[model samples]
Target: MALHLFSSIRGHRNQINALSRVVARGEPGHAYLFEGPEGIGKDTVAQALLARLACLDAAPQAADACGACRSCAALLRGEHPDLVRLARDGATIKIDQVRSALGRLRFDPVLGRVKGLLVESADLLREEAANALLKTLEEPPSRTVFVLVSSKPQLLLETIRSRCQVLRFSDLSPDDVAALLVAEGVAPDAARVAAALAEGSMHRARSLCDPARMALNDEVARFALALGTAPPTDAAAWIEQIAERRATLAQAQGADSDNAEADEEPAARTGKTALTREDLQWLLDVLRAVLRDVVLCGTGIDAASLPHARHAAALHAMANRCDIGRIVAVVDACQQLEQRMGINPNPRLALSALLVEAGLRLRAT
Candidate 1:
């Protein structure tokens, strides 16, 4: 299917309108930097703008592309010669890739009025590659447009950022995310749950829709409840169980299990599978949501208003056993741990520590 029109995108109305106005005026900028949280439709908006610019039958005041036009069809088939897409080769966009892409961007448009270049995850450009790209941005070709998409715009070189017209995108509301999921044929109940846990990321919400991820969420919810209600002495046992389950699930899904090299850290050489940083983060996110629900239950909020509404009974149990202050403390600790996760080398150990800390706080209350 063809890419959705700008009008069809869920959020970023302001950004879309801004781009539409620029296109309508026939003075679109040569380079744009779309910076925002991942999976929040920045790239989608960029593509929509490019489509509008390329459409042959689009009216002067049109807010979207003419989907039936030749240019639009070429885009739909991913055969548009005028559009060049550059993404990281593996870990970074190498100098060679940037050189080649720059060479392509120099060519005249085959069909569309303007040539287009899209650099996905633009922050992954290596130092030399970024310098090469900056040179192109400095002396951009006529009738050409460049869209650089990045979630970590701060990592991009300051000089590179200054040359482009930067557009910032914000997170989508849960309602908007759920609506989009429903439109994509997800069940309403599942969509609402996924959206609530997604933290404004459509990619995360979609992943949460998978049966395996949903099952993992259930386990996390149970673990959260256990932290509140289980005997303090049983904390270690339950934490270990959950950690083992997580490791097993990761293995079942073909996680990173290559034998460690001699120079690797001790944690890697243990020959035992463990939770990754991503796995720990996922656990923390679900735990935070459940804890938030517990706080809501304590404050007499309606069950339906809870993010984990289906776990309202367990949340209430947790809330009744623990006071608001302790629950809040646990939540704060989770947030801090998440913020520090980038430097932490051992995710399984981190998860254990978090669970133990949560148990102590909740048991004290």
Candidate 2:
């Protein structure tokens, strides 16, 4: 079967064409930093650029990969010897990985004419790893291309950032995300809801389609709504319930790791933890959405403009109970929780603190 190459990517035509022009002119840069928010197509564009560089028919003239060449086939199978991809190992990309990858760059292309290195989540590279990568970027190898994909490009070292051509990617519109989801067979209503919640990320829009994820978001949003009406005792109980669930999940995950086979399918492996930082972020995102709706409702914004249209009743009720000032305060607290979650804070404590604070503020209003 022929390797599948990107024919079209939503919201990235300008960036794609710009890189394609570079390839067609035979003046592609040695290093490019594709920076943007998650799911904004930086990685996708990088892959397309790499495919174009590696494609025999596309090189030196064409703007896109042919997708039928042996190089494209190898790329699809991850068997392209000249192309290297580096991802985070746990939390950071270590110095050793960068050193090895850089060393490989010094060698002649193993199979294809162009050597490509793609480093995902480049912001997660450790200081030593960044320094190591910087050396290679400063003096790149011949016929070699390096692409760094990062959502948090500011976290990268200043010296490293200065060494590469930076391409900025903008967020996709909700309509764009919804159109893609509908094309993928999602119901139009569900697709719109997911896109609205996705905050310009198709990656997040896909996650929102997962029943488990949506259920969790719904439960969290309901909890946020209850804060205005539930008693103090009920709020404490809710916190305890969340803590218990986290602990239970942690124990199950530990057991699964100890007993599961190395070859176990990820879907077959049970006991995925729900209290991860990412999960907490999602929870906060849901809360933020609800708080936003409340603010909108309080300020007499049109109901059609709200993302959580299904929860309009609850949102409007909350809006009636609290003024815009109190709602804004809660939203600010939610934002703080998001920042804290990113910095390795304790999940249970951080979540509980935010919920409790939100509850207190809501009740005071």
Candidate 3:
């Protein structure tokens, strides 16, 4: 027998069991809100639930879909007539897309007993689109199920959220993430490192496995340590170095044409190349992780527990050099900078100020 879809997914056993029970009862709710952290398998679980609902051979109380069946084959081919998936076209799901999908859901199932509308990144639904979705959720059609998946569910309309049967998913444990990566042929050491930095997000873990990203992580660790010892006057110079490193990483990653266009657009309009908010945010995240490790080391945590265990010596030295209070102040500054990045037009300037502040805090101790 072929492997069932549910069996391939890792974590979220409680959510899966709840969904399975509903499937077994043959009375799945019309609308479901599957909300969770990104890359924790919410989408995968939603797809599996839909697959089981559509599987012709699925029996009463069956735990999962018959993976070898015709319906399962169609789903695997992305040709399932009864399933309609909606994702962001560019940035938001426009009214037109919602209208189009709603039109399809109005029809009867083409190949199965039920039709499924899986809306990925449902929070990206524009105002008009969300209103249109709200109407459908209020009075959903018979034999149709709607699964709205989002990492940021608070952005969803209250009416829409209230109408759906909400299911919350938690992040995967680091060991679970590492095990999954190892199953996918990642080396044990690399998988462990990626999992530690992933913060329970499998998506981030996979990205961290990229050779370029791994190298960047090392650079970030070194930069964070250097910042702790560097003078406030060097903040501007360090910011410039960060920009150069970002450019190198972008080049190595073969950034897609869309990102390339985005990068070019800003440069053309401003006549100066600046790090995008996303770039700065990623750097901040790395810095935050390093600061966290330093704090943990200072608190007498084991090296194995740190995210950057390979940099244990440096982290320990930094931890010993600066008290927890000073390191925490720097971490707080990094977080505040992250929160203000959206409104602050000059991210580089903000980052420089943060580093200078961090330098002052660390040097004084």
Candidate 4:
């Protein structure tokens, strides 16, 4: 497939500059950890580098391989002998795949000066895969460059990490993200939500750029907002939808959605229940956003000051009823819940306990 490049995120100026510098110097390293969240365009940057390296043209800019050259076109078409991409077919990049890729990496480029091995989602590397790739990283073939992309650097072993140059990618500013999304044909409201929900990852915004997730997020946001006003209202309908979403995401992994009737509480049965785990976590995320606005509000900043300030005005208004410190605690608790999502059961109970704990703290003063 031809590389579908995106207009780079604006704040990635330093990354782009650094990539250009690497290409200009013809000094691409043996190993690099392009560490950043999903959708931040690490893949795009890496491809641009590959294009520069693989371009058949050995003109003055041969080092920054011309995009139109035969080698660059071959890379774009996924036919470049020098360009190798090893991505996890699923959740994990296994040892066998790594060994096979390493075997292939030993070969010279049929069309270019260098061999480029791109490992997408390096975090999924099994320990053995990491070890298998280590020797090559330590003693790479001449003109061979290894680029590994990861959203979760913490999951990688430090020894392997120690051998590679680390490049960190950050979340983009909301305005930058919004502009990018809008440019991609996202509606204004969609651009706003995708940027906010994306939390700085362009892949996330683009992947979730779908109408269903956006609509779901809107419902979840609206429901979370409603909870601030009255806890005893039609929370059931909202939670049922959240459970369905949780099941959907889980099912995508081939996990069974065994949400038996007994798993629900008395209140849940009546459609007036507390939040589900998914619902609670999403609420906490929204609450965190709300509290952020509170912090901004307390600082005398305008409600429109945030990345999602337009969508955050009501959240800021809700924040007026919360203490900053309390909001911090709320965020901490939400993080805890996020970390504990798979481990916890009885989603409704977890949500209720979390809410009670947060309510006691928020309503304390």
Q: Evaluated with TM-score, which candidate comes out highest?
A: 1
Of models 2 and 4, which has the larger TM-score? Answer: 4
Q: For model 1, how does the per-residue alpha-carbon lDDT over 1-365 read when each residue is reduced to its tens digit?
A: 13459988888888898998999998889899999988878878888888888788889999988888888889989778787788877668899998998888787787787888889889989999999999989999988999999988999999999999999999999998989889989877678779988888888788678676677787778778777455654544554565577677655754433221111243332114454566667778888888888888899897666667777778777778888888888889888888987776665566677777777777744
Query: How much does candidate 4 score in TM-score?
Result: 0.68
How should the candidates be ordered by TM-score, best one leading?
Answer: 1, 3, 4, 2
**Candidate 2 global CA lDDT score:** 0.74
Question: What lDDT does each candidate get?
Answer: 0.79, 0.74, 0.80, 0.67
Best by lDDT: 3
Q: Candidate 4: misplaced stretches above 4 Å?
A: 1-10, 58-65, 206-208, 220-276, 287-365
Q: Model 2 reaches what TM-score against the true structure?
A: 0.64
Q: Any idea what lDDT model 1 has? A: 0.79
In model 2, residue pairs whose N, Cα or C atoms come closer than 3 Å (at least 3 residues apart or on different chains), thus clashing, are none
Q: Give the deviation of candidate 3 from the true structure as CA RMSD.
A: 5.2
Q: Give the better candidate number (2 or 3) by lDDT.
A: 3
**Steric clashes per prediction:** 0, 0, 0, 3
lDDT for position 157 in model 2: 93
What's the distance in Å from true for residue 226, model 1?
5.3
Put down candidate 3 lDDT per residue, 100-130, tens digits, no spaces. Answer: 9889878888777789899998998999999
Which ranges of candidate 3 are over 4 A from the true structure?
Answer: 1-4, 36-39, 90-111, 123-139, 151-162, 170-209, 226-233, 248-281, 298-300, 316-365
Candidate 2 vs candidate 4, lDDT winner: 2
